[model samples]
Target: MRLSGERLVEYGEKGGCFVKKMTADDIKDIRELRELLEVGALKILFSKNNKQTIKELELICEDFTSMVEKGYYGGACEADVKFHEKIIEATGNERLLQIYHNSNIPLFHLKLGNALSHMDDYKQTDVEHRRIVDYLKNGKLKESIDTLLEHLDRGEKESIEF
Candidate 1:
């Protein structure tokens, strides 16, 4: 027996599913999740010696800088996502990818976009991102991880204040 579309629609209608509004605690949790994911990804990427990864990160950093320069703050936020996503991909861990995917990244991007819109020195962000790439390129794992965490921390603070 095959299920009809109308029956499936009726079944779905009867089975309740709802989207909840994000609470303050939820926002805090997302921020912490982002920190953990980004820091862990950076640690993993730092452990590897991949010149190609560094080059990709450099390209993403340049794209972010260009986006900010053009006042495309939303595009800048997307570039920021791509920057971190590349780091996460470099880790080469499937579970980490799953965790990153499960997080509320779109909402995080929205908050980041809003924060970037209010910032006076967007170039400072580009500099921080470039510093991270520089550290990774130079094979400075400890410095790279430290810089990455600091960058994430600043983002968290800005998102919270926004």
Candidate 2:
């Protein structure tokens, strides 16, 4: 977990290791970094946007919806990660992709810490996901980015509350 950058363990000043409690500040920092990388890559994603790309995102959205309906919040979180990842990977920048994975943003959003994994309302998320894909499919970069920001902001708020 430490090697994965999940940082589940923290070393004490005296050299003993123990579980690290995740704080709101930690979640804020991770969310902000995620925003930076994801938002920065939007232009590249727009450039590479295509029907196939949109379809892939749509499929992820379908999976997310299905998971939410099944009451599998963990699977829904996984799908959420995949949706954002698909957008980033669409940029075709290997370094950016590697950095994104190394940053452990996906794990942060997953059930490991249970911070953002238990969002109270999944319907809003499903709608937001579809709206984003619709904006992308219609070549609305600004709208898509705005929706993405809103989506991320909602998750950050929920994570902080958790």
- Candidate 2, residues 74-112: lDDT per residue as tens digits? 788788888888888888899999999888777666743
Q: Return the clash pairs for model 2, or none.
A: none
Model 1 lDDT per residue over 16-85, tens place: 5333444556556766787788888888887787789999999999898888888898888888788888
Residue-level error in angstroms, candidate 2, position 27: 1.2
- Show where candidate 1 strays beyond 4 Å: 1-24, 119-121
Q: How accurate locally is residue 7 in candidate 2, as Cα lDDT from 0 to 100? A: 77
Candidate 1 global TM-score: 0.78
* Per-prediction TM-score: 0.78, 0.86
lDDT of 2: 0.80
> Local error of candidate 1 at 51, Å?
0.7
lDDT (Cα atoms) of all candidates against the true structure: 0.74, 0.80
Best by TM-score: 2
